[model samples]
Target: MRIAILGAGSIAYGNAALLASLGHEPVLWSPSGRSAGSLANGEPLVAQGAIEGRFRMDVARSIAEAVGSAEVVLFALPANGHRMAMDAAAPHFKPGQVAIISSHTSFSGLYLARAIAERGLDIPVVVWGTTVTAGRRAGDAAVNVSTVRAKVDMATIPVSAAARGLKICQVLFGERFVERADALAISLSNLNPQNHLGIALCNFTRMEHGETWGQNENNTDSVGRLLEALDAERIAIAEAAGYTVRTIREHYHLSFHVEPGPVGEMARELAARGNGGNGPTSTDTRYVLEDAPFGLYPTVLLGRLTGREAKLHQAGIDIFSALYGRDFAGENDLLGPLGFADMTLAQLKALVRDGWPVEKAA
Candidate 1:
C-alpha cells in the first residue's frame, strides 16, 4: 500500500516508519519542512518506546509528490488543524483515492466531505477517532510508541462509504478498523478531549511552569474524579445527540493493555504504561490545545443543542481558553461554526432519529 502522511510529528514519523518497515511505500510531509528534509536525507529520527521494532522513515518533498500515485492519503495532523489541512489538500484530492484521517476527531470526515463537495470533488474518507495506536513524539523527529490500539472505532461521514473506507484503512493498518454509526460517535469517542481537558486544566501550572509530570503517575483520585466528570459531559453530549458512545474505561481496555477498570483506574494504568520514568508526561502536551477545539468544544455544543447540561465540559473549555487567552469556541466547531447554530433542540433530536443516511440533507 502506498501511503502519504501529512505532518512530521512523532505520530507521523512513527506511523511512517511502520509503513516503511512493512515494505509499504510511505511519504511524509509537513509545513515546517524540517522533518521533510530529514526524511528526504534518509535519516528520519525515531524515538523508541514500549512497542518494539520502531524506526522513522524519511519525509516527502511535496504533497503531490508524497502521495505519488498512492491510493491512501493518510493525514496525521491534529483535529484542530484538520480544516486548514483539508483546505490545502482539497486541490490535491483525485477521484478513486482514499483520504483517511489516521484518527478522525469531531466530524473530520464530514469536514473533509464538505470541503471536497465545495470543490466539486468526491472520494472515500475513513474517520477514526484515536489513531490505530497510541504514540507520542518524544523529541524532534522521535516518537514513543505506547501500543497499537486494539480497535479503531470509525464511521464514514455519509455512513454510505463504510465498506470502502474500512477496506482502505484495513489495508493501511492491517485490520484495526471498527466502524461506528455516524460521525457523531467518532466525535464523542475521541478520548483526548476529556483526558486532556481534565489533566491540563488541573495541572496547568506544571504545563505552564514547564515542570515535567507523568500522566498516569501524577493523576490521582482527584484527577480521576475530574476526568470522570469530564467524561460524563462527553457521555451526556453523546446521549443528547442520540448516539451511544462507549465510556472512557471501555476505550482504554479495548485500545490498550490495561484490563477492564474504572475510567480513572484505566487512566492511571495508562499513565504508568507510558514512558516518563513512571507515567505519561503532561508538560507541553497536545492534550488540551489540540483536543479542546475539535474534541471538547464539540462535545459541549452537542450537550447545548440537545438540552443536556455539560457543566464540566463547558468549564474545561473556559478554563483552557482563558489559560491560552483564546476563544476555544471558535468557528472550527461542528454544532457552532457549521451553521448548526440554527438547529433547535427538537430539530437536533430529529436529526439524530434520522441517522445513517442523514435525513436533514436528505
Candidate 2:
C-alpha cells in the first residue's frame, strides 16, 4: 500500500519506518518543512528498539505531492495539527483513498468530514483511540520505538466504512484493531487526556523545573486515584451517551503491557520495564497544551451534551487556562465554529452520522 504520513515528527518517523519495514511505500511531509529537509535526502530512517530497521522512505516536497498518489493518508501528528492536516489534504483526497488519524481527539473526523463535504468530496476516515506504536526521537534521522501495541481500538465515521477501513489498516500494520460502533466511542475511548491530566497535575514541578523524569514511574498512588476519578467521569459521560469507553486500567493493561495492579502501580511497573521513556520535561508540552483543549475540553463538552457533571474535566480546563493565561476552552478549532449553543446532542450525533451541512457563502 502507498501511505502518506502528514507529519515528520518522532511518531511520524517511527510509523514511516514501520510501514517501510512492512514493504509499503511510505512518503512523509512536514508542515514546517523542517524534517522534510533531512528526510528528502533519502537516507533511510533508522529505527531501533521494538521495531528496528534502516528503512528508506520518500519525502513529499509539498502537501500536493504527499497525497497525490497515496492510497492512505495517515495524520501522525499531534491533536492540534489535525485541523491543518485535514485542511491541507482536503483538496487532494480521492474517492477511494482512506485517511486515518493515528488517534482521534475530540471531533477531528467530524471536522475533516465537514471540510471534505464542503468541497463535495466523500472520504472514509478511520479514527483510532490511540497510536499503534509508542516511541521517542533518538535523533534527527532516527527514532526509538518502545513497543508496538498488541491491539488498538478504532471506529469509522458515517459508521458504514468501518469494515473497509479496518481491513486497510490491518493489512498495512499487521496489528489487531477492534472496531467500535461510531466515532463517538472511539473519541471517548482515548485515555490520553485523563491520563495526562493526572501526570501534569502530580508532576507539575518536574515539568516546570525542566527536570528529567520517567513518565510511568511518576504515576504515584495519589495521581492514580485522581486519574481513576477522572476516568470515572469520562466513563459516566460515555455510558450516558450510550457509548462504551474502556477504563484507564484496561487501557494500561492492553496498551502498555502492564500486569494486574493499580493504575499508578502499573505505570511504575511499565516504567521499570524500560519501554516507557521519559515523560514531558516541560509544562508547555502537549499534556497541557494539546490534551487540555482538544482532549479534556471536548470531554467536558460531551458531559454537558449528556447532562452529566464532569467536574474534574471542567476544572482541569479552567486550571490550565488560568495557569497558561490562555483561554484553553476556545482552542478547539473543530468545535469552536460549530455554534454549540444552537445544537442538541441528538443533532450533533446526526451531524456526525450524516455530516454537517457545507457552509454557505455569506
Candidate 3:
C-alpha cells in the first residue's frame, strides 16, 4: 500500500522507513519543508536502532501532492499541528482513502472525520493510543528508532468501521494493533500525557537548566510514586468513563519489553539495561507544549464529563501554565471549536462512536 505521512519528525521518518521495509511505498511531507528538504534533495532517509534501513522516499512539497495518490494518509505530527494539517488536507482527500492519526490526541480523529463528512465523503479515521515507534531525529535525513512497540491500542472513529480500520493498520504496520471499544477508549488509553506530566514536572529544573540526564534513571523511587499517583487519576477517569485503559506499568512492560513492577523500578531496569534514553535538554519540548494542552487537557475534559475530577491532571496543567507563562487550558484549539465545553457526556460519547452531525446517523 502507498502511504502519505504528514510529518517529517522522527516518528514520521521512522514510519516511512518501516513502511519501505515492508515493501510499501511511503511518501513524506514536512509542513515546514525543512526536515524533508535534505531527503528531497536526493539524500536517502536513514533509520537506525530498532528499524535499520537506508531508503529513498518521495518528498511532497504540498499536502495535496503528498496525499494525492496514497491509499493511507497518516498524520504523524505533534498534536498541536493536527488541526492545521487536517484543514490543509481536507479538500484534497479522495474517496476510498483511510486516515490514521498516529497516537491520536484531543479528539482530532473526530475533527478529521467531521471535515471529511462535510465534503460528502466518509473516510475511516484510525486512532492509535500511542505511536508505533519511539525515536528522535538523528540528522536531517536520519532517524534513530529507539524501539518498535510490541502492541499498540487502536480504534476507528465510527464504531462500525473497526474491522476495516484495524485490518488496514495491521496490513501496513503488522499484527501489533489491538482494537479498542471506540475513539474515546483509545483517548483514555494513551498514557503519554499523564506519564510525561510526572516526568516533566519532576524534572523541570533539569530541563530548564539544559542539564543532561537519563530519562529512566531519573525516574527514581520518588518520581515513580508520583507517576503512579498520576496514573491512578487517569485510570479512575477512564473507569468512570466506562473504559478499561492500560495501566502505566503494563505500558512500560509492553512498550519497553521489561518486567512490570513499580514505575520507578521499571525505569531503573530500563536504565540498567542501557535502553533508557536521554531526557530532553531543552524546555521547548512536546512534554509540556503538546502534551499539556493537547493530551492532559483532553483527559481533564473527559474527567469532567465522567464526573471524575482529574485533580492531578488539572494541577499539572495549571502548574505547567504558570511555569511556561502560558494558559495551557486555553491552548487547545480543537475543544473550543468542537464545542467540547458545552457538550454533555452522552452527546460527546455519541459523537465519538458515530461521526459528527449526528442527524446523518439518524
Which structure among the candidates has the greatest lDDT? 3
> Could you tell me which 10 consecutive residues in candidate 3 have the lowest summed lDDT?
353-362
User: TM-score of every model?
Assistant: 0.87, 0.95, 0.98
Decreasing TM-score order of the candidates:
3, 2, 1
Local distance difference test, candidate 1: 0.68
Please give the CA lDDT of all the candidate structures: 0.68, 0.84, 0.90
Off by over 4 Å in 1: 44-47, 50-58, 270-284, 331-337, 344-362
Candidate 1 vs candidate 2: the TM-score winner is 2
lDDT: worst 10-residue window of model 2: 353-362
Give the CA lDDT, 0 to 100, for residue 347 in model 1.
54
Worst 10 residues of 1 by lDDT: 353-362
lDDT of 1 at 318: 83
Candidate 1 C-alpha lDDT tens digits along 1-362: 77878877766766776676666877778856665565466655564664555454646667766665576888887766677777677778777787878677666676576666665555667777787645666656566776666688877655666788787777766877777876667777887778877767777777676777776676677887887777887787778667787887787677775787666677667666553233224444567767777777767667777788778878877887777788877835444444566767565443322322322332
